[model samples]
Target: MTVTDTHTHLYSDAFDDDRKVMIERAIAANVTRFFIPAIDSSYTKAMLQLEADFPNHVHLMTGLHPTSVKENYMEELRHVEELLSKRKFVAIGEIGIDLYWDKNTLEIQQEAFSHQIRLAKQYRLPIVNHCREAFDEIFVVLETEKSDDLFGIFHCFTGDIEQAKRAISFNMKLGIGGVVTFKNGGIDKFLNQIDLEHVVLETDSPYLAPVPYRGKRNESAYIIKVLEKLSELYGLSQEVIAAITTENSKAIFKV
Candidate 1:
């Protein structure tokens, strides 16, 4: 079976000491696809270098993450436009409102998020969203920008059934990761209600590790743990889980 890791940061500083080993471990576990999310211009070089180093396995995205938005967000948005002009990216991502960290720049965060969503539409690419304690804010923008032309994944989704339905209404898929395995993750309560085809697997490496690895650094190989949990929740085999989610990812990313 070919498992797809829809969101991972292979170039994260957390993996600097053993990036190769982590990737090899993932590959050995049959996790064949790696989709990398972009943070900002600061991580552009590293993301590109990662793709260059593993062209077949790694896919790159370009965008300014929500938390990365600040006073001079226009400058960063300009940088995003510049990168899009130079080459194609799988998606415009890891972009959304992040109120968990700071609510002071909420206005600027909304502006940047909307701008990037338009950019994604303009480029005809899907998006990978990063929302934390700001689903309402993020949904407001998504509601205004609702169109067949705009759609993508809500990365690391940890919302309720209502939010999941709302996201799907906007043509977005819910990205499931290690949280589904958490005792109080909340997602598991309603996940079974949603079909497996609407879900995608992710690790969000260096963060949100599954049960056994909770509080520890996460790697792509650990995606299997998530797959296992999903299987138990849905009463499906690992191969079926991987196949359906992989197809779900391809439906969104077109990769």
Candidate 2:
């Protein structure tokens, strides 16, 4: 049962002390494929090095994260453009409006989000969306960018059935993570209503750890808790949940 962590910052400094040990732990638990999302140029080197070290298991995505979109965002997008032009990546992602951090930069966030969406479409790549406190804002951009060519995962989904349906309408697969294991996470309430094929599992590592590890640092291996929760919520076995979500991930990443 190989589980796919669709979005995780495995290259994050949070795991610096024991990165290899942490990854081996995940592999032992059958949580293998690690899709690393780009935050900015600052982490690009680490990301590439990580992929080189774990060439067969690490998949990469290049884009400007919403929170990283600041005064010189154009320069950052140029960095993203240069990478896309020169490398092979699974997607253009972890990009979208994040009003929760800096409401003042909403306009620029939207602009960057739209620009990256175009990049994804142009490259025929899937997008890994990161939306926080800006569902309406995100939907606004998705409304305009809607197209057969625009498809991706709504990373770390935290929405109701209505919103899940809406996200699907925009060609996105919902990324379910540790939040599904939280007592008040809410997605569990209506998640089963949405077909398993529309959802994928993730841990958003070094963040959003599942129940036993909630409020502590998250890691890829902990994704098993998420898979277990989905199994209960969907009335399937842990093995089945892992297999289906892994297959759902392959459908999105085409790996």
Which TM-score value belongs to model 1?
0.99
For model 1, the stretches where C-alpha displacement exceeds 4 angstroms are: none
List model 1 lDDT by residue over 47-116, tens digit each: 9889988899999898999889987789999999999999888999989999999999999998998999
- What is the TM-score (0 to 1) of candidate 2? 0.99
Candidate 2: clashing pairs of residues: none
Candidate 2 lDDT: 0.93
lDDT scores in order: 0.93, 0.93
